[model samples]
Target: MSRPQQVLASYRSLLRATRIAFDGDHRVFMAARQQVRQGYETGRTELTSEPEHYDEIDKRLEHASGVALLLRSNIVQGQLMHRKANEEPLSTGDHGIASQSDESVYKLRIHKHTELGDNDAVKGGKTSLAGTAKKIKWSNIDE
Candidate 1:
């Protein structure tokens, strides 16, 4: 529309973008707001005189809005990652939430011979690791 309106819209958009870019950091937003306002005031006369530059001004405002949107997306992604990291320790059986489905099947002999009777030499309980090893007299073999 009019040059004055266009200039005001751009100025306002710049302030809004600056506020978003800093997220909730008020100190930085205020500093950026002041600088943008001063810059807009100083350039007001020049913008009004150059009617042909309206298209270029619109493009620049559009670009600034896009950049702010991207910054907000980036901030959201970072927050998601932080939240995921915090949630991990509570899941995957780390914080005493062990998954019963993962019960180890390491007792192979017991599992394979679950039906064995008392007469069998295999035994009635789970096999120990040391029991799997047999000791032989190497001296007799050497003799």
Candidate 2:
């Protein structure tokens, strides 16, 4: 309809796209983690033992990591956009309320990204700890 309304709609669409991207990235990370665990358990010592498997898992993990970084950057940008939108008061029209809603959605998306980052960090930490424990056990056996 109006300029403000169009901006609001575009913001809404970007927010939705960001959310979907985040979800897909999260799934990719989970799958990669699972594959790593399976590989370790199945006694695949060499990275080239199953070249295709290793490559797929590596690519997925890399993509997930990149997406996570992108999401963090997007959160910052979204906050800036929300702040800009708030500073400029909307006129009384169809765009007015939509602009406000857009700000709210942006804030919500920022919160979601923060939460997702925390979750990913926790999962990665746990995986690291498990791997360290396994190494320690093997070292002890060798000694």
- Say which candidate scores most in TM-score: 1
Model 1 TM-score (2 dp): 0.38
| Candidate 2 residue-wise lDDT at 83 | 38
Candidate 1, residues 35-112, lDDT tens digits: the string is: 877766656555554668777667656765665454432332011112333243323221111222232211111111
TM-score for candidate 2: 0.23
Instruction: Report the poorest 10 consecutive residues by lDDT, candidate 1.
Output: 105-114
lDDT of each residue in 63-136, candidate 2, tens digit only:
54555445443443222224355366543331111234555433222222332234554566564322231111
Q: What is the lDDT of residue 94 in candidate 2?
A: 19
lDDT, candidates in the order shown: 0.46, 0.39
Specify the highest-lDDT model's number: 1
TM-score per model over all chains: 0.38, 0.23
Q: In model 2, how many backbone clashes occur?
A: 0
